[model samples]
Target: MNASTTGLRRGLQTAAVGSAAAIALGFFSAGAANADTLVPLPDGSITETLVDGTVVTITRTGETANISPSMGSTPLHRNVWVSGSTKVEVSNGGSGTIQPGYIVACQLTLGGKSGTDGGMSTTWADPDGAAKQTAKTAGNLSIGPGQAVDYKILDLELADPFGAEQHRAANPYKGKGSVTWADSTLGVSGCAGYAQARSYVKVTVNTANVTGNVTLWGQPFSIG
Candidate 1:
């Protein structure tokens, strides 16, 4: 409850940052790692601390919120890195097209980096009956250790995904879209290595139509 103590607590409460060494060990809530030398946290979970000038890290059992868990087969969303930053800006990107009972597929760009990097992802089946899945990313992104990138993966207009009956060739359920992510968030401030930062993207499509559902399972893309 002292002024100095209150300020330190507030600072640490913010997303932990920077590199360093600590003058004194600090009190952290339980579940805190024993110390820089204690039993390591399980893999996936992350723990970092900055005290005085010391930087401490402890690993643990957990999932990187952004990276999807590995699936039996290719996951519905998987991250792939591109040459550019992963931070992207998407507009309503102009209204997407939807006809009475047909799906117009998004054009695919094929070949080299442009081809390999840009394209509509394969349409995946909705595992559950309800169309709950869609492409998207977690809020504010973690670009690297102690670093974060900010960007909005603009939502595009599309029809909701439907059931098995709607997956017909003639009544094609589709729309067009383009994705771009840049590491523009990183800079000379606390975020270092401006040129090396990156961002990850998850694309989801689910929209509703009068007669049928239309949707594309999410696919994760990474930009550097």
Candidate 2:
């Protein structure tokens, strides 16, 4: 083959390799994000809707994990979360609060134990005048020979004038828990959460004024 032809072939081969590398990089990046996936608990899980028309699912990972943010570092006794990497696309549940846009709230629990007593919750907010994230754990359980009582586990709470533009009173709590059931007292342990996972996450990029979507990655993330 001519020298020119040989050189052209080499150049094409190099280009092909570069494109392949790019594609491989894209796939790897996506995989890295899943390192933080929220595993289901020991025979426990819950699916609920946020006031903002977005659905949220919770599951507990039998293991424990550490979450470090600007506030501080916390070691979640048991791994449980709202599935941080899991994303979803949703329409506006309510009108924009500030107007010309919507909001998105993503939440993950550092530690969660459910269907029992006392658990952790954590909620991360994304919008104007918001904190990075917050978590809490709280619960109550009572049993008696004559009667038994099961205090309700706190679900997501909404603020007055609830909606997409509104605020969440509680959600995404975090912490560890165990059952100390005896003939007498049932030891209940934990705190409570208060923030907001409005199901509103800002699209990494957008031109529209109204924040119709509330997501972390801008587009739909983990629905499947």
Candidate 3:
């Protein structure tokens, strides 16, 4: 072959190889961008004494959060699937209702031992104007920046006294009861900042003489 022709052929081969390498790199990058993240969370438990000398123990076990890429393929959208179980034990033949759920927040910090955003408390009823409450039972949440909302995992449908169908977030129980949830969806949108979620179990116990409430908080984890 002529000198110029040989050089041209070699250059073409090099360009082809370079293009193939680039395509492979792009494919791997896309796969990594769309990959899911599995988070094994730490289990937590709490014990509280009621006003009537009744002891209550609440335990949260097998907690996990599977964070996924943005559902909308944008920074404003975050999706997560959470799984966990809550067990409650009451003393003195006390009965109670168990409420297990998650608290998802955007840009705002949760108030607690591990979370302290402007000294705000992360209780079930947020007296602070940070986040508005929602009736989203199945974990489809929508909130703006600096906002947080509660997500109940259970949606117990029952007939009311008037024969109308109603949904209850709490499950009534006797001495000992437990609830398990799997693959609960938590979809957040309309927030351009970082997002986080935490698990919570609130139990309202009633004895023959008095009634009280005990709450257990879980570790907070990032969604995006």
Candidate 4:
């Protein structure tokens, strides 16, 4: 695949200053030629250096990584609206074991209007426009031992019924949610050993005029 496409897949696969001062000084006197020349021994010489003269070094190493995904549910003012999108970020929190070739599947629960509920539906979509009514999975790219994958879900379409009862019933939009995704499934192909397989899925919800708080949860997995 192309670079853009590859990056997109990699992103969806996982389920996913200060300053100091210093000074240096030199002591020298120009007197008569007969005057004895005083030499300063290098007993850790004192020098007047500029504040920026000092150097600081930082080193990074290893292949282990961590992925984090966050989802938000916002109250829509309109009768018909979409749930707040979810943003997933990946971090290389030091080196750790991760599945080598695999994808991540995420699932979300779209709570419907409670109380005198009426017609309310929700739908989920991935970055690639793939629809996910429930939890969807994606992945199968190579993530350097210390690398990470991140992406967002922007398609959570919600349709709600217009009425005070419909809104009051769903007063406290409390629902159980889950996100399940895995890297590409690994297997032998032809004479080659294990290789990567590409797959992608989106997570979304279907609800409207949500009057309560929404929470999202995810399960963790590592690639071999």
Candidate maximizing TM-score: 3
Weakest ten-residue segment in model 3 by summed lDDT: 111-120
TM-score of each: 0.18, 0.21, 0.79, 0.16
Per-candidate local distance difference test: 0.25, 0.28, 0.82, 0.21
lDDT of 4: 0.21
Per-residue CA lDDT of model 4 for 23-84, tens digit only, reads: 11112221122232221111111112223332111111121222211111111110110112
Candidate 2: residue 202 Cα off by (Å): 34
How many clashes show up per model?
Answer: 31, 27, 0, 45
Q: What count of clashes does model 1 give? A: 31
lDDT tens digits by residue: candidate 3, 1-224: 89999999999999999999999999889868797899999999999887778999999999999999865888889999899998999999999899998877777524322233432245434423323566454767777666677788889999999999999999999999999999988888887678888888989899999989888888889898
CA lDDT, candidate 3, residue 134: 61
| True lDDT of residue 14, candidate 1 | 57
Candidate 3 yields a Cα-based lDDT of 0.82
Clash count (model 4, backbone only): 45
Better of 1 and 2 by lDDT: 2
User: Which candidate's lDDT is highest?
Assistant: 3
Better of 1 and 4 by lDDT: 1
Q: For residues 101-205, what per-residue lDDT tens digits would candidate 2 score against the true structure?
A: 111122223453322122111222323333222222222221111111222122334545545443332222112112111111112212122112122222221
